[model samples]
Target: MQRRYVVVIVALLIVAGAGGLLVTGVCRVRELAARMNCMSHLKQWAFALHNSADTFPVERNEKQVSAFLSGTIPNADLPPEQRLSWLVSALPYMEQSHVFLQIDSTRGAGDPRNQRPIENRFEHLICPSSGEYDRSSRTWKSAGPLTHYVGVAGVGADAAALPLGHPKAGVFGYDRRTAIPNDIPDGTSNTLLLIETSQNPGHWAFGGPATVRGLVPESAPYLGDDRPFGGWHGNHTVWSSKKSHYCIVALADGAVHSLTNATAPEILEALATVAGKESLPANW
Candidate 1:
């Protein structure tokens, strides 16, 4: 009986160890999958932006584009959540044609035509590695208007009127250096475009102008901001390894690559300017 009891205890211990390993493996695999999916989501949006730029002239007036499109410039007139919210616009390209049709561009938020919830609860928007998605409520409150990706505007507010001046104004759109055509002699891959942003509620630190109305001041600390208990998982923050190491950027050549972060301040500054090619470091 004593021998049998000892054997049972040993077996239990082995079972527990195996279970622990299995759980650990599963978590790691899930995390990797989430990151890959996020990258894929970014690629889809990048292609969409490329297509939009192709349709619109690079040097065209920003206000004119907004007026022609009815105040829905992806990066210009539109707010952050709605600005880079190309998940609706790029639906067809990403094998989600049905969702795109649901968005009534003419109707504002409270319109009767806005029947289907504007927020997309699709698993694609939710990063499996992070807890941005509220599974119970089926909403994404971190960044406004139900989104997974974030935009990077190079030019500030005053510079939006200048050609390719403000790349950091809205989500997804880059400055002239990164957004314009490659043959134009003004472009760089190291400059930021759209990065994966954390969806923080109330204080949207990373959201662009569109989400400006709902965002808290950047002075707010991340401590009590109770979304989850982890560091930033996306490329926007300094904490992100993927972004600081090799950020995936869409280039002027209409190509995308994971670029090295070992870039000079001048290089980064040049990339921020619309006429970066004229001023950027030759070696960059």
Candidate 2:
């Protein structure tokens, strides 16, 4: 009887160990799949921005572009009337032409017609790793729909203060000038274009100029401010406080790269600028 009991105990322990390994493997696979999907989404966004620039060249200053696209110039002086986000302008290239057509260019993002598209949830814009979507907890706070990705505004002490027409060296600007390939003197592959965040300030269609200031460290404390550069996963301090260890970013060349929480803030800032003429790190 004693021998039989020992044998059964050993068998159960072996089964338990095998189950633990299997679960670990499955979780790893799922995490990898999520990362890939997120990268794919970033690629699509980069391509779409390129397509938009190709079709609508940035011929004039930021004010001119804003006037042409949104029928008004966005600036700190007139905060309430400022509308038209970069995402809305790129909708046609994103396979959202029908939705784009519905948007009234003459009206601001708050307009009823423009709000229609913003209110809808877009799965492609949501990061699967971020887990289930919750409209109630959007970063924009009832402004419109929420997004997990945002553009790098620029790298400087006053990055956030720059008006729409005069954006810093980043790929995207507020309803400002559209950046063509020629604008990025630092090489497209080396410049950062878009980044993922658990919390985003503007809706995909609202065109409120969603951007991240590269001044803060990638792993900086959140402080509940939605304007800084950071993510929900990894070392970022936002929403649920869970750590995912890495943040996803897309370069101007439409290439996706994974940035760990420990990546140097200087490297991130360098990548955020368009004409800063900075060199990438050895590993980057």
Candidate 3:
């Protein structure tokens, strides 16, 4: 009986060890899959932007009718013909043309008539990684419009915050350097375009943080690590890697790159600018 008991104990221990390894493997894959999904979203948006850029010099009537929003202009003072974000405009390119048509471009996105598109839960665009959400409500959507990614408006809160005569040096925002893909003097692969974040991502159809965001450095404590513990994830703190130490960003070339949280602020600045001409660190 003693020998039999010893054998059973050893068998149980082996099974537990195997189970632990299997669980660890599954968790690692889950994180990797989430990261891939995040990257895929960035690529889809970037390709749409590229297609939009290809067909520029659009007619004023076309812009107003199609709700084809522009991010290069600063709408706060001299707003565009339509106060829509380019995300709405690029819907057609992303194969989501139906959602684009639902919006009544005759008025602002907040117009009562445009509620369907504005409040829509574009599941494909939502980040599978992190955000404050309630899965227990038997709901799989955000209360309002949500976007996990935003256009990089150079290295500030937005393009308007840059110094006078300074280029927006980004693909989107008030004074963007790359209105067309060719405008990126620093090479498309070397520039930052759309980046993923769990910060206070404003409305999807409306303007503001919903569309363009500035690439600020000095992210000593990326909120992703502490946010799951109930800290405020607001104040424009960028969070791409949920419960992680890295962030995912897409370049003008439609390539997604994983950046470690420890990446230098200057390196980030270099990538954000269109013509900074700053060299990256070795092996970066």
Candidate 4:
């Protein structure tokens, strides 16, 4: 009788352990699926950007095309700074056909016609791995999420002058591999174009921290706490694991990799410069 009781106890313990393992495995699989989806989202975006460049009109006369559309044209009625966001242009190619139709590019950005609620199809803005942010304050969070991706704004306003009249100047567009594909005098690949980032504007707002400066005319809504793209946070979690690490960026080359907090600041700077890729340190 004693032997039978001991045997039953052992079997029950074994079953419980296996059950725990099974639950953990299922969670990991879900996490991995989400990350893969985010990666696919970025890869598709990069391709769309390339296509836009191939199709958009190109004119050599600086300040001819709307400066909002081309970095090469500067100090015009509409500065290159006023250009439509690359994300907005990518709607159709992203399988967001409905969204593309809703946006009215002909109207001014501030026009009420441009605003679309998340239910209207903007939920696609978020990434599974990135969490939401607190709008009342600029900070990291896990609620009220917005997007799981972000856009690269070039190095700074100073660098903007270099590609001043080129169609792809304000950003590290696909042509970053080459100068506006023959327009700009000098351009280089391995130069950072689009990078994977959490859409939390609080941390990574276009200009900088909100405390340091006020919001820009174009980015006020995004900076709102209700939106998730308020901070500059990144993701760093092990494959098949539930725990998350800091920011990890997806490169224009379709490479999804980690960018640790320990990464050198110069490495990011080097990746941003149109010419910096040529002089990359051998160690990197």
Candidate 5:
């Protein structure tokens, strides 16, 4: 009887161990699926951006091209509030043409005509890893719908402070039209375009709040804090995996890469510029 009892106990222990391992495997698979899904979302945006550029090529005369999609035209006597963003301009290519048509580009994102589309959530823009949608936070309050991704505005101490229409090294400048292939002197493959961030203003319709203006080091802790560049993955602050600190970024070439927090800051800065003339390091 004693031998039988011991045998039964051993079998139960083995079964429990196997069950734990199975659960762990399943969880890891799910996490990987979410990451892939996020990558797919970035890919879609890249495709739409390239298509938009093709449809509306930039004029040879830089002055003639609309700078940031701000609702107001440069040198025009329009109020600052009349600004719009690249996301709004690229709507037609994203298959959101109906929403795009509803927006009056001449008016600001706050215009009532843009309310419906601005508030509507785009599932593709949300990261599955971001968890349940909670709008109670300050980032989401009155910010319209939330977005997991944002554009790399430029490389500077404060690119966001620059006046609208000023030249930005990054692809999405203020009040600017879509960047063409020729604009990216660093090669489309090297230029950073968009990034997955949790610190967005949650307003996909506007551009001012959807851009990362400066080069925040990848090693910077993902404090999951409220900072604009902070991570939003649960209690973890950075947008990285448990095994490593990393984030997903899309290049102008339409390729998505998993960048680790250990990535060289100089490389990150160089990637944010269009004509900085900087070369990627050998290791990169």
Candidate 6:
């Protein structure tokens, strides 16, 4: 009788251990799927950028083609704050032309006429790994469904003030930089285009934090905390296993790289510029 009881107890322990392992394996698979889905989203945006460069009219209204692909749609007479995001301009190429047409170009991105389009929840602009922000109520989300992704405003803006204009070495700026293909002194494959961040304005239809962000020192990724795009500033545990060990980014060449949290700050800077003329480390 004693031997039988021992055998039964051992079998139960084995079953419990196996069940735990199965659950863990299932969870990891889901995380990976979500991560890959997020990568696909960034890739689509990259294609949109490329398509816009080659197709947008050279003279849309007044400014030259460079001006249209310019990061902001600011009228010469308007303040930078009132400018529309380049994201709006790229909508047509991204298969969201219907939404793009809804926007009134004569008005600012925040105008009442643009509200209907601003509320659109673009699934391709979101990452499954950013589920913590997905929980926010529609009304509370204000601008629209949150875009966990944001443009890399360049590595130099890693200063105290947010430089939204000139000298933004990245691919974008406030109507100051051009998105023409191969325009950068640094090759497309060598430059950073976008990054996964939570330290943004959470909106996608406007400029500034809504569309771009400087890779400032405070915005380290995966370190956890609201240190910019590094990790969730709010509750990190919003979803099961959401803390990622690496930060994901898309290069101008439309390639994705999973940068580990321990990646040196200098390495990131090297990748952020278009004309910095910096060389990356071999081990990086």
**Against the hidden reference, what TM-scores do the models get?**
0.53, 0.75, 0.75, 0.56, 0.76, 0.79
* Candidate 3 deviation (Cα RMSD): 6.9
Candidate 6 residue-wise lDDT, 1-284, digit = tens: 99999999999999998997777677667677777777788888887877777675354345555312555676775554566777888889888889898998778877899888878877777666666435345223334556777777676553112232233367776655544443466667877787887555466777666777667654454234455554522222332555545567888887987665677776777777666778787777
Q: Report model 1's TM-score to 2 decimal places.
A: 0.53
TM-score of 5: 0.76
TM-score of 3: 0.75
Indicate whether candidate 4 or candidate 6 has the larger lDDT: 6
lDDT of 4 by residue, 1-284 (tens): 99999999999999987887777677667656665665566566666656655556455445222111222212233333343344555566667767667766554233466555112323334455554432347444543323455544344433434443442232433122232434322242444444544333321111122101111223323221232222233332433443333343444444555444444454555554443333566654
lDDT agreement of model 2 with the native: 0.62
lDDT over C-alpha atoms for residue 112 of model 1: 53
Q: Model 1: which ten-residue window has the lowest total lDDT?
A: 64-73
Give the range of the ten consecutive residues with the poorest summed lDDT in model 6: 158-167
Candidate 6 wrong stretches, greater than 4 Å: 1-5, 57-68, 76-81, 132-143, 156-168, 179-182, 218-225, 230-244
Name the lDDT of candidate 3. 0.62
Q: Which model, 3 or 6, shows the larger lDDT?
A: 6
Tens digits of per-residue lDDT for model 1, 1-284: 99999999999999998997777667656655656665676666667656655555433444322100111224454444333233444455656667667766544433456445454455554444456666678765454444434344444443322343333332233223233533233543444344433434222112234322111224222111132111333333322334323334344333444433454434544454434444554566
Q: What shift in Å separates residue 209 of candidate 3 from its native position after superposition? A: 1.7
Candidate 1 residue runs with Cα over 4 Å from true position: 1-26, 56-71, 74-87, 115-117, 132-145, 155-163, 166-179, 182-188, 201-284
Error of 3 at 123 (Å): 2.2
User: In model 5, what lDDT does residue 240 have?
Assistant: 39
Query: Model 5: how large is the Cα RMSD against the reference?
Result: 5.7
Expressed as tens digits, the lDDT of each residue in 1-284 for candidate 2 is: 99999999999999998997777667667777877888898889878876655565554444222111221225343342256566666677878878778877667767676666657666677776666454456442343456778777666644544554333446555434435455666777887878887654455544434433345444344222242443533332332455546678888787888877666667777787777777777786
The residue pairs that clash in candidate 6, if any, are 220-230, 221-230, 222-230
Best-fitting candidate, scored by TM-score:
6
lDDT of candidates 1 onward, in order? 0.42, 0.62, 0.62, 0.42, 0.62, 0.66
Minimum summed lDDT over a 10-residue window in model 2 is located at 63-72
Best by lDDT: 6
